[model samples]
Target: MPEVKEFRLPDLGEGLTEAEIVRWLVEVGEVVAVDQPVVEVETAKAMVEVPCPYGGVVTARFGEEGTELPVGAPLLTVAVGAPAETAAEPASAESSGNVLVGYGTGAPAARRRRVRRPGVGVPPLSDGSADGSADRSAVGDPAAPDGPEAGGHRRSSLRGPGAAATGGEAGPVAVVSPLVRKLAREHGLDLRALSGSGRDGLILRADVERALRAAAAPPEAVPEPTSAVAPRVPAAERIPLRGVRGAVAEKLGRSRREIPDATCWVDADATELLAARRAMNAADGPKVSLLALLARICTAALARYPGLNATVDTEAREIVRLPGVHLGFAAQTERGLVVPVVRDAHLRSAAGLSEEIARLTEAARSGTLTPADLTGGTFTLNNYGVFGVDGSTPIINHPEAAMLGVGRIAPKPWVHQGELAVRHVVQLSFTFDHRVCDGGTAGGFLRYVADCVEQPAVLLRSL
Candidate 1:
């Protein structure tokens, strides 16, 4: 006899409680291997392929694509230990260790053919039925008067259709999608009173919407008006803030509400920096990137003004100065803006930094960056100059102390060596949490960066 198992969605790290289903990798009636990716989900941080811990024949899947499921919701069911004729080998009860936060799986199992029991009343695997028998009272069966199809209306067996219902007790409401449940709750609709139209009598959003419309409809007895009337206005389009956009909104909102922040800007002649970059790239070694150079300068500036490279612990009422710099650079991709962190950035050289930045940028554009790659930054270097902008007061990434914004480096009129001349110049804007440091420290840090930008050799002293 085959033992059926239920696989629920696990907690993908970083306190994320829910994720939207992007795509399904496996289908019902498909054989899956241990620790094999079964579904792709988009959380607040990034898109992740969640692997199933159990290796068996998939019997059923719960949600559809684009459905947002909370942690711990049932994802699918697997029929393990099927008969030898059905599978290549018998499945062991042991699972491979710890694939996600909550679940584990054992060695990969051989592929097996999907097994289907006779009839729809077969209780779900969660019901713990040793014999593979469908629950006859399952939803959607017309014969199931006391089932979910009755819309929670329980009746006395002795009485006919006109008899009063007994107990006023209702059966389970067949609603699966959380979005549908939320919609009904927000509109104050009773799920038990409405029968579902979906397979298995599962309630859907369309059913709820139709009910609302019918409730709001005017009486048919009202006579049609002969006079011309104004046209009806179209409803506005709504976009849900759920995945990356929602995360950004939440972090930025918290930054604004909790942190007392300030911004300072300065314009610098970047001719030497540009010349130095060209000279460095001209060498036979790895080519240096302008952003990498800026990042290197930021690290040196933080070394001198470590106060700006720290976070404020509100509970302890103290500034937590980070020992090493984990630099985050903002990259805009088709999905949205993301800040991928470069670990131990202060320890990397110019060429090393360039390599890391390029790799992270590529990962960000391809939507492959992990949550670990997106978090833990002591400072952020935002090169908005790529957008061809002059300057911007960027919002500080929450929990981090400061962010340095670099604007477009273009030819500009400047007084160079006591003469007015066209020079490559760039604007530097620095935003910091006032709670971490005073304006003096912030100004010094910005001045140091601007100095390094103006004179590339100035950075050599720190190196």
Candidate 2:
């Protein structure tokens, strides 16, 4: 006998509301332990494995892979206190000690599996329990209504645009892909109205496209009967802005809407900086990166002009100047661009910054960067010049006061020592929130950065 308990999706933090099921670790009738990862889900921030709190036999799983569920939606039901052939001891209905953002332990109790008596209207839970009543939803039954087939439909429409796709006589609309769901929603197509051409009547992107094409065709106009082959109709590809790409889009949009931003540019001769970096790498135990040298210069400049290192508290009408520098560096990966923050960057040496930056960059590339690794930045240093571009007026990362953009350092003609010569020149662009400070502060910050780039010795003064 067992008492059934349902576990819902827990909040992964930072006000995220939903996540898509990337993988499922457990199945119905399988025994599980407390705090065991039951599913891997992808939120807007990162991928996380969610664990179940109850240790018991899995009775039901609510969602399939690729299904997006809201924060409070039921994920699965576990039958606790169940007596199995491999039972170690008598079980009681109790929860694990660990708690997530929106999940908690329940009261301890014990109950038997429900049994319908003689002339009873309800069905029994399992045939093995007490009086040998047959369970309608058996684990081995392929025709069970609460099995995988029905569960996919229930999870698909939980918080999606296809809410109408659930529960009908012909069975639930077989939609598994989120893109197909999105396509149907965009064209105002009812998924329940069409039969999917896929295996087990699963709705795919092609089926949604076919629906769109059929609906868009003119009622009166017909194709002419001609020997010439018809031209192929090109369909537009739509990518959903939901994960890291979506977060970037939303943040950038908000920054443009709220911040009165200004960009100032100056070209600097980086011959000396390059020479110093080469010399450091030649003599140092661990080689320092060019980006690290630039970051070192940035921290020094920020120390001189603290006004640019602050964010505006709009409601309080006060500028919040941060005491220590938590520097964020922009790194572009296969998934999308992410800014990994280096905590207490102002205190790190050039070699130390290089090491941390390398570690974070590798993490970003492998998509292992945590939410903590990606946030809490007092300032950002964007070295976009690695893309071989000279300069760009990049949109500021929202809430942060300013960003320092460094362009590619290349040999160019410049006036040096009262004579024209080829020198390593780089363009430095600074974008700052006007709400934080006037042009004087912004100009001072950029000027100091350019000075350090021109003369590496200028940084040693602050060091």
Candidate 3:
């Protein structure tokens, strides 16, 4: 046998399980050398090219474009020792440097891990990290360790199945079966929390719920194992997070959890800005909203106060300032909130802004926005005023320094000439991450935005 090496999915990034196959760079029997760009895979982050680790004859491709594959699964087959493995020119190393995802420095799976299902190497439902617990010898290979016949996973360590599989002092294993893990994941249940009541504590879906119910209940209930059902809201409809709603939930959750927010509000008269929008629409051109006009003002103000137009890295203690202003237009989809970026908002005219907003809104509603469109936004603008909201605090998108919320542009009584007069007044709210800016800085930014909306001609000075 000509030394055939199995090139399983290499670790792409830290803690990533699977990636969508993007494209294949080379064809079978094309005589590829080592470290050549073999396939392109798309993760949540980006499309990175995976390079061939061993040099040889092309054997087989494991997947097709758009097919997502789990890490450690065979991607392709290449027979080493042809003019291939050693045939490459020694001086040309740049050709191999392009290989991107997987094959990194993270440690492989834990030692003596337990198994729950087949080929899927999901760890056994366990809360505590894989440390001291369970029989260390129930199976063999720590990485795989999927229990054979335990659904399809190969059994690695052999704690005599005492863990959940057999149920003894042994805790949970990291490896889980495919079907069980999939079910658990779909239900938003953490497998680790489950105390399997199966044969030896082998976790089941029922077990997952039981564990959840137990955790959700107070500690007093464990001793009195009576027939008292826990009073909880059963899901009207259990939903598996996927598609646009899933993406939105994930992004918003990250924004809410990771970003600290402080808000500053100011009153802005959008009378002139509204007029500008109407003029642009009356020109029999692309229709625009006050949002488009506000975006223009924000683009200008960001130039003045570059700090608010930047991103704050809470851990790294760094602020990334983007040069161009790509305003994120918040669209309320039936699914959830999706903010599509209007790239280089400063360069586009009012008509262009209007058109792009229309295009993005249509795409968001239709679920056609691409993944690339979702990332790389420097700042965001949310207009709640369309819904009659008069200034509300909005969470800042993670990493972004600030986000602006526009309230209802309704008539409000104000003192005009020493007497109260009705004016088309609006409230402006700005939420910024204090890690990057102070209250004074955020307040100054809102004031600037307010000024731009009230006197639209002031913005013309910059133009």
Candidate 4:
């Protein structure tokens, strides 16, 4: 027998006790080297890749993809050399940590996963075993559990987990998030006939009640303790928490906590900026968004006032500056918020910046944005202006010295040609880490950005 080693899930970061397994880079039977990326997991912030801690032949992956696993659980078993005693054989029940108290191997939540699914927006099942498969809940008959019917009654179903959704009579059903499950007993819900729209068809309490309301009312006046049908138990599986989400929560929290900031704002005439956009949109391969223009302006401004683009090392008592600009554009996703970086924005043109920003947005919407897109942002732009807001102070996306919030462009009274007139005005709010950039520096950078936007022709010449 080969010498087998179990890869127990490590404390990814933060105080998170569990994570979801996103994907496995290395499959069973493949030879893996130490430190090679073997799997990807998500905790809360983003998906993180977990490298193999040991080198050997991959024996078994404890959980299925997209499952959440608790911390300190075994994720994979590897068979080392020699007689191959390491991992070819299965672990004993005791060593396997198999029990009802916590999560385990059937679900491979190796790490926190930030990766979101695009088309099917099913949030992960808490147990981590959502590979298009439904399982029996502890709350009911594993197979053919009768669900709550109308007026707090139960309905029966002979069909099993993989069976098709039936028509004609609406069976037991409900709708709700997982947090509502605790109220099941109080509300008197039956889980069996519950056709859940949840991640893996797990019966949510709302589904329980909806199913109950849709079914025929019981003839008997008295309410029963439970549903009508309860079949024999089916095979159940365990889900393991991978540590992916743990790492993300740690990173986001660290950023929010350690970074200190100060902010300044200015209203500028955006007629030129708007004109520039229209002209660019009329002729470009990829039309530039107001976001790309804002990025270009900020990168140029950072060139002079690098303080606004610096990174603060609060723990190390150090501040670092960069030569090029990497602007993280915040991409809102259903799972959560994500920011994908646009590398070296200064090097790219208005059109190039637009193309890159468009690409990242598409990837984010499609849930295909890579980890590289999510990190290393030297500065950030929150285009609240696009939402038609006049102006508001925006929080700094930590480490980076400052973040700019662009407010709406609307006709407002302003001095143009030494006369008060109505002009398209845009509000720019710049929040900087005061430790690195004083108010003057922040004000100066905002001024520079305004200059570029006000005289877009100069932006072309300056480039």
Best by TM-score: 1
Cα lDDT, all candidates:
0.75, 0.74, 0.62, 0.61
Comparing 1 with 4 on lDDT, the higher-scoring candidate is: 1
Report the lDDT tens digits of candidate 4 across residue range 126-239: 222435322222122122224332113343332222333444333323322322342343244544445665655655555656765665364456655487767557556332
At residue 301, give the lDDT of candidate 1.
Answer: 90
lDDT per residue (tens digit) for residues 78-115 in model 1: 77654323333454444556757332234442443323
Ten-residue region with minimum lDDT total, candidate 1: 155-164
After TM-score superposition, the amount by which residue 463's alpha carbon in candidate 4 deviates from its true location, in angstroms, is 1.2
Error of 1 at 84 (Å): 8.3
TM-score order of candidates, best first?
A: 1, 2, 4, 3
What CA RMSD would you report for each candidate? 11.7, 9.9, 13.9, 13.5
Highest lDDT: give the candidate number: 1
Q: Write the per-residue lDDT of candidate 3 for residues 1-463, one digit (tens) a residue.
A: 3344456677765455777665555444334555665666655533455677565555456665445788888887655553322222221212233344353212221122222321122222221224412222111333333444333534433223234544454433332333354445555665555566665456665676675677557655446557887877656747645434555677778988877778889886667677766777788656776677788788888888987778766678788777888888788864467778888887887668777878888877764565456666788999997887797988776667799898988887877658887878898999998877899888888898999888887887778
TM-score for all predictions? 0.73, 0.70, 0.52, 0.58
Ranking by lDDT: 1, 2, 3, 4
TM-score of model 2 (CA atoms): 0.70
Off by over 4 Å in 1: 83-94, 99-227
